[model samples]
Structure formats: C-alpha cells, structure tokens
Target: MTKPTFDLQSHSLHSDGVLAPAEVVANAAAAGVQLLALSDHDTVDGVGEAIAAGARHGVAIVPSTEISAVDGSYEDLHVLGYGIDHRDPALAERLRAARADRELRAERMAQKLNELGFAVDDAPLAARRAAGKPIGRPHLAQAVLIHPDNAERLEREGHDDVSSFIPAYLIPGTPGYLARTHPTVFEAIDWIHEAGGLAIWAHPFWDIDADAEVLGAIDRFAAAGLDGVEVFYPTHDAAQTKLLADRCAALGLLTTGSSDYHGPEHRLFRTFLAHELHGYAPDLSKLEQAAARAAEAAA
Candidate 1:
C-alpha cells in the first residue's frame, strides 16, 4: 500500500485561524495533504465541520484536540489528542469547561490591558466567543496595535505577530499579562484516553527545555498512557528531530510531525510555514501507526 502524505496539525477559525474548518480542509487538499487533522486549541467544536469538509475534499479528517497541560510548577506542557470522541460526554464537558476558562482569561487579560492604558473591547471578544469562535491572545494583540499610543510603538518595535506583541507586553509577568488557569497534564491525558484517543507530547523543545524536565514529564505521561511524542515539529531542527525520534524509538513511543499551521493570522508564522523552509514534509505513516496503536489499546 502507498504511504499517506499529509499535515497532522492545523487550525481553523474554530480556534484562531482565519479560515473556516471547511476552508482549511479545502486548502489542505490543495496543498496535497491527503490526511489532515483539525487540532484546534482546547475545543473540538470544529471536528464535525472538518469531517464534512474532508468528505468533500477526499481527505481523511482526524478528530483531534490540543490540550494545554501544566505541571505542578505551572510549566506549559501541550498534549495532542487524536482519534477522540468529540461527542463523548466527559470529553465534551471538559472541553466546554476549558472554553469557559479561556473566555474568562481573555476577559481578564483585556481588562488588564485597558487598565494599563491599552485600548481593547471585551465586548467584541465576548461576542465573537459567543458566536462559537473562541477569543484568544491574537485578538488582544491586534487590539493593542490599533491603540493610538501603542500603534506607533508597536510598529516601531517590530512586534508584528501575536507572540511577539504579547511576549513584549502581555505574557505572564508582562505589563498587560493575566495568568489563566490550565488543566493538569494528568487530567488532560486521562480525558483523551477515556475519549478513545491517543495523547501525545507536543513540541517538547520549544519554550520547554525537555531535558531533565522532559524526561520526568515523559515518565509521568507514559504512566498516564501517552501514546506518542511530536518528534518532527516545525520548531525542531534536524538534530532535535533526530534526538526526539531516537528517544521515542527506544521508549516504544510513536513519533510524528506536523506544520502546526494556523494560517496567516497566527503570530508564529515563521515556524508555521516550516514545510517550505527546508523542503520538509509530514509523514502520515507515523500518525497512522500511532492511531492504530491507540485503537488497539482502547479495544
């Protein structure tokens, strides 16, 4: 059988991307992506639309979610879930709770920015969220850029994307920062597994020093039934990818890759378009193997 070629990670308007879930599916079809996943942040609301779009585009749409997991010390540990049951009551309740928490955080962040003399409207943020598109830091960053006093400063500072703009002034401990509560890694992994999905550690090297910390995290995740690790992320170089791949191989963990594409709106544009950088490509064989293993485990 011929191996599948595809991008495993992508976002739609369901989270923060510009395109709708259908549009994302269409774009991936155009990009020659035979297997696609709508790994929307925190919510699985777009999976149904993605499935409909995939049927139309002849692409396999994998049901996926990206959970924000934090350890006891409050470090960010992203866990990717695949083959999950979007309608599973337990999973849905958790996702809904997460969405609510995200809304609360965005509101708090907007209030903090307003108090800091930055122009932002929590109303529209809430309105957009009510319309099913979750509000995120990107909206807040854009609001900051449009502020009269900050506009010139933002442009002068060359903080174009959301990450840079937020990092400069809105991340935790920053001027306009407001910390949001995140789900624990154990909770998220358990939820994913219970929802008939596979849990994967995502982007271990970016912003997260996956040395001793990562090894410790890996141990915990393995005990919790983590099926894979994202070894070939756009954030990783060849050496890093190899190192992760070797680790996964030795540990009997499935390894996978993806562009983590969030369209043009995302601030992380530099790495999001990674496939074009080094002529890289995502291999769906890895994802398939992981999915198979997860299905077997669930069975």
Candidate 2:
C-alpha cells in the first residue's frame, strides 16, 4: 500500500502544541504531507490561520478540533472533529466552555502541586490565560520544572523532562492530579455533527482505560454516533493497527491515519508523517463524502 499523505490529528500553540498554526502547516508541508488537520484541543481558533498557510504551501487543511471528553470509566478520551465549520457559533460556544473547564482543572492542579511543595509560578499561566491560550498540564509541568525552588528536587528525583512530570504528578492518583470536568464523549460527537464534521476517536491506544477494551469501546462510541476511529498511529503496533482497521471495516466506520504531531520539541510522537503510518493508506473517500454533505447542508 502507498503511504498516506494526510495526517488527521495534530496540534498548535492554540492548544498544547508549541508551534504556531502557520508553523505547523509549514512543517507538515516540508514533511511532504499533502493534507493536514489543525485539530487543536477544544478550539478551532487556529484553523483559519492554518488553512491560509496550507493554501500558500500547497497543502489542504481540514478545519478540525480535538475535544477532551469522558466516557463511563474512561477519562480524557479525545474525540477528533474533522472538516468542521470553524465559525459555527454553537461549536465555538461549547469549546469556550470546555476551555474554561480546562483552566479550572489546570488551576486546581497547580494548587495541588503547590500544596505538595512543587510550587508553580502563576505569572506565565496568567499570561497564557490572558492571551486566550488554553491552559494544559504541560504548561503547569513547565512551570514546575522551571521554578527555582523545585529545580533541585526535580533534578534529584530524575524528572528532567516535561513528559516525566505528567505521569509522576499530574495524572490520576498522583499528587497534582485533578479530574477534568469536560463534556461526555457522546455530547462531543453530537457537537461535532452539529458543526458538520466527522467525529473520530483519537488514539485509542493512548487511553489506558480503553486500551484493553478497544473494540468494545468502539462499539459503544459507534452507537453514540462516532463516525470513525484513528486506525493508524505511531504508537500502535501492527497487530493493534490491523485490529482497529478490521473492526472499522466490520462496523462500516471510517478508518483514519495520523502522526498526532504536537511539535518537534515534544519528547514523544513528535514526527510529522511518521513511518509507522506509512504502511496503511486511509480511505479518504468517506471524509470527502462527509465534507460534501456538510457543504450541501450549509448551502
């Protein structure tokens, strides 16, 4: 099979990604990605900029967003909305609410960190909030890593990378962990549909809670109107990828592929158009049909 040229999941500084929207497009174009989705977490604010950059760089931009949602017994399960109307008022409102919730979670996490003696500076976090950028655990981790008070402790504890802080302190059952109060996965799927987009479960393998029950969760999500699953990902082994692809086929759901690129500075899954996804070509006809329907509905 020919390598897939489209990456359905990515991020920008509009969310947790370090690079700006145009920078992400330029990087994807340089990596020979023909189609790129600027699926920032909980916001499409960067999609317009990314689309313009794509036009300039000869790449197609799929207006998209990665919504952080939950299912029963599954927390922080991301749902990717592709080919969305970036300007949809209802979608914007819902995303705003989600981002607000994220801010609250981040704040609570920071407080917990402080209580645990891992103080986080409030200035940078305040600046991010002031600039309308989403507050994520990464930002908090950066704060923790950079604080003069925590430097010796972090170095002594062998926590040199931002990624190390996440599992150690910010995730569930940790000292700084704070539960998210975001929308349910089903509600997120409905929001994506209302905005004229296809809702796909993003990176099932990354969600530890859902990993063991991938096919079962796919059935549940499909029943709740999920349009697809990200069948090809950098972390998924051949067996896992094939399993997801076969299940998507059996269920008549779209199977998508992506690098889930955050940025080059990221410690893991940093490559755009990763080689792991090159073996499987995603059937984009389904996506095109969905886009056509969306356009017709708009018209």
Candidate 3:
C-alpha cells in the first residue's frame, strides 16, 4: 500500500500566521501536501477563504482551529479541533472573549515595555491588528524591533522572527508578562465536541516529563475525551515519538503526524519546517475518514 501524504497543521494570517488562507493553500500545494488543515489560532475566520482556494488548488482544506488550553497540571497546552463548524456561535463567542483578553494583555505588555525604556508604542501593534490579525507577543516583539535603538541592539543577530525577543521579554513572569488564560483541557474538549469536531491533544511532550507522573497525566487526558494525540511532531525525538505512539496505541487513541507548518512568515519557521527534512507525512486516508466522520456528526 502507498503511504498517505498530508500536512494536517498549518496557520494563516487570520491568527499569528503570515500567509493569507488562500496563499497558504497554494503554498502547501506546491510543497506537495494534498490535504491540509488551516488550524489558525482561536479563529476560523480564514477557513472559508481557504476552503475556496483548496478547491482551486486540488488540495483538500480541513476547517480547523488550535484552541489554547489549560489544565490543572498544564498551564499552556493546546487542543487541535478538526472538522469544526467555524460558524458555530458558541465557539465564536469563546474565541471573541479570548481575543478581547489578548488585546488587553498586549496593551499591558506594551505599557510594561515602555516603562522599561524600550520606547515601544502600541500604535504599530494596533495597526497590525487593525487588519484583523491576532494581537500576540510576536506582534509586540515586531513592534519593539521596529524601534531603531532596539533594532540596532538586535542588528548583529540578524533575526527577523520574534523567537529571541519573546523569551527575552514576554514569557510568563518576565517583565512584559501578562497572565493569559485558556479553558481547561476538559472544557476545551467539550468545546470541540460541541463544534462537531475531533479534539486532539497537541504536542504532549511540550512540558511532559518521561515518568510515571506523565503517564498518569496522559490517563487523565484520555478520560477528558481527547480523540487523539499528536505523536509525530518534529520536536519529538525518536524515543519520545515512540513513547507517545505506544501510549496512544495502548490507550486506543488515534495517532496523527503533522508538520505544524507555520509558514515562512514566522521567526521560528526555520525550526518546525525543518521537520520536513526528517521525513514527516501523515496518513491522509485516516485524516479524510476522520474529517468525514466529524462533518457527518456535526451535521
């Protein structure tokens, strides 16, 4: 049997992504991904445009979103919802609330940086978001780098992405840190279900340790109605990948392989896309079936 090829995770400018939804679909077609998902952050605002473009490009676009999530044990985990009804009112309301909070947080972070003498202003950030992009730490970092003084300080580094600046300033407990929140994993899973979607736990190894403690945590996630786990992320080492795979199989959970393609616009784009060099592809038949099932269930 031929191996399936798909890239189930990507982003668009509707969130923190650089590419428009249609442009992302076109690029993914060029990269040879026949089936793709534009899982923008917290919004499905781009999915309609992407679905139209996917039809033109002959690539199937999965309408999806990556929901920020929190758990008692995990502060910054994420949940990937596939086959979502992007127009669902409840989902839209939740995302609106989150975006509103993020706006306030970005404003506070900018004020914090201004007080700390970075000379950063909220104008550029607000303007960038005026076009309907997510107001995120990256947008703020880009705003900071726009300052000639800070730009000169970061000049020798030659970095166009915000990877370096985020940890330097915006991480939790850092100077520009603002406490953001997400629904608990349980609540996020319920939201996905409500949207007639399949909720997959995104990148479990992010903060999970390899121990009985982590294994116990996995069990808790399974109990929370997570349909699958992202076992084939680029960051998962060979052993870690196998560990997640084993856990998924043992628990009878669906398995997914995704590039988590953030596109070339990201400062960290070089990092995640590098996984493609290591040969990352997903089983499209499985993904297609899952999408069909979710669509029917949603209908």
Question: What overall lDDT goes with each candidate model?
Answer: 0.73, 0.85, 0.74
Evaluation by lDDT, superior candidate among 2 and 3 = 2
lDDT of 2 by residue, 184-280 (tens): 9999999999998899999888785355598899999999899999888888888888888889989999988789898997888688877365356
Candidate 1 Cα misplacement greater than 4 A, ranges: 1-4, 264-299
lDDT of 3 at 44: 85
Ranking by TM-score: 2, 3, 1
Worst 10-residue lDDT window, candidate 1: 270-279
Position 149, candidate 3: lDDT: 70
- lDDT by residue (1-299, candidate 1, tens digit) is 22225567888877867788888888788777777778988888888788777777877777899887677765456788988877688898888888788778777888887787677745656667679767778778877765566777667889755777877777656877666557888888898999988888888887566576766667678877888887767668776766666667767887666778787555564133253223323335655654444334433
For candidate 1, the TM-score is 0.85
- Count the clashes in each prediction: 0, 0, 1
TM-score of each model, in listed order: 0.85, 0.94, 0.86
Which segments of candidate 3 are over 4 A away from where they belong? Answer: 1-4, 155-160, 207-214, 265-267, 270-286, 290-299
For model 1, state the Cα shift of residue 89 in Å.
2.0
Winner on TM-score between 1 and 3 is: 3
lDDT per residue (tens digit) for residues 177-251 in model 3: 876666778887898889888888887776666656556767888898888887777677777777777787789
Off by over 4 Å in 2: 209-212, 288-299
